[model samples]
Target: MKILVIRRDNIGDLVLTTPLFRALRQRFPEARIDAFVNSYNAPVLAGHPDVDQVHEYTKGKHRKGFSPGWLERLGQMWRLRKEHYDHVVIATPGVHPRQIRFARFLNPAHITAFVPPGWKMFGVDQPVEYLGKDRHHLLMTYRILLPFGIEGDPPAPRIAFTPPAHSPGEAPVIAIHVSARKPSSRWPEERYAELMRALHERHGARFRLFWAPGAENDARHPGDDGRAARILASAAGLPVEAVATNELEGLIAGIAACDAIVCSDGGAMHLAAAMGKPVVCFFGESEAHLWHPWDVPHRLLQPESHDVADVTVDEALAAFDALRQEANAA
Candidate 1:
């Protein structure tokens, strides 16, 4: 049997869907399992052992206002139709109509998806209701396989990146992901610098600042470049180094090299969790229960004001200290 799982979303979302791939492979040991993801997130699934193939959809290049890239999308659809998949699972929490239409084109024998609330859908062999409160996304994505008796607390997100050659360096090297697409979720740069200094003094820990290139060019809200620079300048005498990468794979490699991560609630945090590294995550306006580091020893610091900037340096240091204690205990 052949199975295709579609989860065309961001890095964090793709990471959350990994357990579903594992479940499918476990249930059908001899089946060929493939994943369909967006180009930006394809690297997360590229070297996955459970997935036989990784199909990338370049949404940015192909999507426009109303029409989108109909010609290219249709051509890709035609190719998928010829794959003769035995089962197709729409592994996203909320299934979009366009994705539903695409699944139809695959002509799979069994179709499964999570149907949004208050909308009826036809042609799906199995449909699970989306309940997005308190529940983590890893468990949420695994619900799509309920009809096949694959039900449990899904395994944590795991990735298979070729671990970079071990470099003998400072112990407990902490990576600080200093960017968030949402401003509310971004802790102040000066505060981050303070946390770094504190960690360095307390544990002799070195720091790595991780940020995506062109993040400062985002028209919606441009500030990451300035933040990265500010962090470096503030840590002038400290052992803090900035590590920026344009490609997802490069970013993964950089994160893999770190012993742990201090990041906002975003892709970098999820990546660190997949790599089985302990994390100190700052949550602002984002939901903590749903998106916190999964199955990893970590501490999540949230502000009462609901703004990441309101989370004090001392508070962050305390969290990091707690994370270190947990790591040491283990």
Candidate 2:
């Protein structure tokens, strides 16, 4: 069977859907399992044993500096249509009408997706009634494959990347990501500076600071250069090196090379989980249970006030200490 799984969303969302590809490959070993993803998240699947190929497209807004010709896009669409996939799984949660229409044009023998109660999602051969809460759970995306007789606590996410070499007695490297896509999730850089001092003193840890690149004032993709600068300045004497990741793949490689990660709940946290690294994550505004790192050793601190800023530096230190203890015990 030829199958295509479509997941066009944020980096974390695409990572969450990775388990499905593994399940598909296991169920039909001979089948061609390809992915239909956006350019932003396509690198996540690089070298995935289960994924035979990736069909990537950039959204109109994402085509700022690099836009593939319309003829190229048309040719890609035509080739997909010619493939005549036996099954196509809409790997997103809601009934996206535009994507639904797009999937219909592919002329797959069967299409499966989650449709809300009242909405009749045309062309979806198998519509799983979407439970509102399912979207929030990290592994709940697996429900999309139930109709195909695949069921399990979807396996941990996997990303293929070579990690940097590590020595025996050197201090463990920790990836510190300063990403605040949502305003409420922003944590002060001073607190991060304090935490870095404590971590280095207490655990003898080195740091690789990762963050959204580009100017914070960039209209299209506003990032955290200003915040990262402040955090670096505060840690002048510490072993905190800024990791310049110009591409999504570079970020993945950096995380995979680290021993652990400390960051606010976001794509970075999810990527760390995928690489099987321990994590100390902060949850604010975002639901803790929904987006928490899955199947990995993690401590998610979401204060009752529901703000990351409200979380203390002492709390972060304690969490890291605990993870280290767990490792030593193991």
Candidate 3:
């Protein structure tokens, strides 16, 4: 049997979907599993062992209404139709009409999607209801496959990536990712520098900064490189090294090398979790309960005012300390 898992969303969402692929592979060991993902997030699934193929849907200049991109999308759909997939699973939060239409276009023998309460949709072979209360997003993705008799504890997100060459002997390396597409989710630069200084003094930890280019397009302040420069300047004479990666694959490799990570609620945090590294995350606009690092030793610091900037340096330090303690205990 062949299966197609559709999760054309952000990097973090795709990361959370890894376990579903594993569960499917475990249940049907011989089945071929293909993933349809957004081009930007394709790297997250590039080397996943459970996935047989990774198909990318690029939304570029042709993405506007009635453009050349629609033809490309249609052409891709035509190719997918020829695959004769046995099942197609839409692994997203809610029932997206566009995705639903795409699922129908594939004409798979079985169509399964996550639907919300009171949602009535036609053509879905199995409609899984999303449990929003006290459920992690990773488990939510696994719920979609429950009808297929995939029972047992869901696997955590896993990635197979070569770690970049970096060594900090006898000193723990903490990675700091200072970029968030949402301005409200970014903690202040001064606070980040202060936290770095505090961690360095307390644990003699080495700091490695990770940032993606073009991050300033959506950020309120400067992008990742700019933020890294500012933090280094503010906390002068500190053992902080700025690591810049042009691609998601490079960022994943860098994060895989870290002992722990301090990041906002975004793709970097999710990447760290997939690497099985402890994390201390700052949450502002995003829901901490649903999006926090999954099944990893971690601490979350959220601002009372719902702005990441309101999360103080001391609070972040405390969370980092707790994360260190948890990591040590484990």
Q: Best lDDT goes to which candidate?
A: 2
Instruction: Report the alpha-carbon TM-score of model 1 versus the true structure.
Output: 0.92
Error of 3 at 87 (Å): 0.3
Runs in model 1 deviating more than 4 A are: 61-69, 116-120, 132-134, 163-170, 215-223
Candidate that scores best on TM-score: 2
Q: Mind giving the per-residue lDDT tens digits that candidate 2 earns over 16-37?
A: 8889998888889999999999
Model 3: lDDT of residue 110: 88
Per-residue alpha-carbon lDDT of candidate 3 for residues 84-195, written as tens digits (9 for 90 to 100) = 9999999887658778888998899988887777675776878888766457787777788877987678888987876545554577889999878777888888887788
CA shift of 4, model 1, Å = 0.6
**What do the candidate models score in CA lDDT, each in turn?**
0.83, 0.87, 0.84
Model 1, global lDDT: 0.83
Could you give me the TM-score of model 2 versus the true structure? 0.95
lDDT head-to-head 2 vs 3, winner: 2
Candidates ranked, most accurate by TM-score first: 2, 1, 3
Error of 3 at 150 (Å): 2.1
Over 1-330, each residue of candidate 1 has an lDDT whose tens digit, in order, gives 989999998899999889888888888989999988888899998778899999877775435466556576678888988999988889888666777778988899988887866656876877777776638777777788898899977877889875545456546788999888777888887887788888999998888888756656777435467678878998889998788777788889889988889999999899999999999888888888788889999888888877888888888888888888887888
Instruction: Count the clashes in each prediction.
Output: 0, 0, 0
